[model samples]
Target: MKDFQPQNEEVKAIRVLLHGPVGAGKSSFINSVNSVLQMRMTNEALASSTTSDQSFTIKYQTYKIKKEGKENIYPFVFNDVMGLEEKTGVKEEDIKLALKGHVKDGYKFNPVSSLSDGDHGYNSSPSISDRVHVLVCIYDANASEMKEPVLQKMKKIREAASELEKLYYPS
Candidate 1:
């Protein structure tokens, strides 16, 4: 598993976007995947061990896995974003923008507002390399069942992700 590369020549690597409700372990998952790939414990992606109501991550960050003892990186990468909350956290429109590759890395998220075409964080013409190859929603297995509003919001995200995927990979 250490020596991994994408079969498609057009794709340099797969970018998996990770998002979920606040405190769902999205960042931790990125670190975990990184650790597995490096064969060592790594906490490069900061995460709050304690539970909290708000998101610990505020900016959009992409994580690349390095192949141990090799100069090249793995054929897959992980993208971590601010978590979703019912009334706060990352805005839905922001996720949509990210799915379409409009959101650039290091852009701080505004729970109240989404990025527009003119925003510095917005990429008007995102290339295929900037787009997400996969959408991963991390769920907290030990948490209680989600409320209706949050569930509805997640459902909407799923639908939007599907639409974006179709836009990228037409069948």
Candidate 2:
């Protein structure tokens, strides 16, 4: 396995996707992270708005973080994708578009579009790696019956990423 290191001083931004099951409080978590960091989301590029039943539909939210003393702005992109098990209205394409940026009908999402080559149509670009740095996979800590579903989803995510790495960069 490759030893992972923190980004260099020149590398200013980081892409993160907050994926998990429904009602696992992904959106709430995002709000809390911003609250702690003293930042607010300004540019909402994805489906952040939804009704009560299917509110968490968007794959993710791209946020621009401006750290103190940093010359370049850090892109704190967080993808709040649908639950893996019960995907009601969510589409795989939406997931692809959220992380790597997408381009459709003259509209351009550079990040999503860059990730269109992977098995799940994600970015395979080295410069802009489309893998989740920190996948905040949430599960109901209290629920008993439904706990397994959430856990299974998290396992699938890990397995998928691991399998992908093994396929592309096998030892």
Judging by TM-score against the true structure, name the best candidate. 1
lDDT of 1 by residue, 1-171 (tens): 566666767777777899899999999999998887777999988998899989999999988877755557888888899988889999988988888889999999998888999999999998776888788889999999886777887888889989876776799
Tens-digit lDDT string for candidate 2 (68-117): 55444435545555544443433334443443333121222222223345
At residue 123, what lDDT does model 2 achieve? 36
Give candidate 1's TM-score: 0.93
Clash pairs, candidate 2, are 60-79, 60-80, 100-111, 100-112, 101-111, 101-112, 101-113, 102-113, 115-122, 115-123
Q: lDDT (CA) for every model shown?
A: 0.86, 0.47
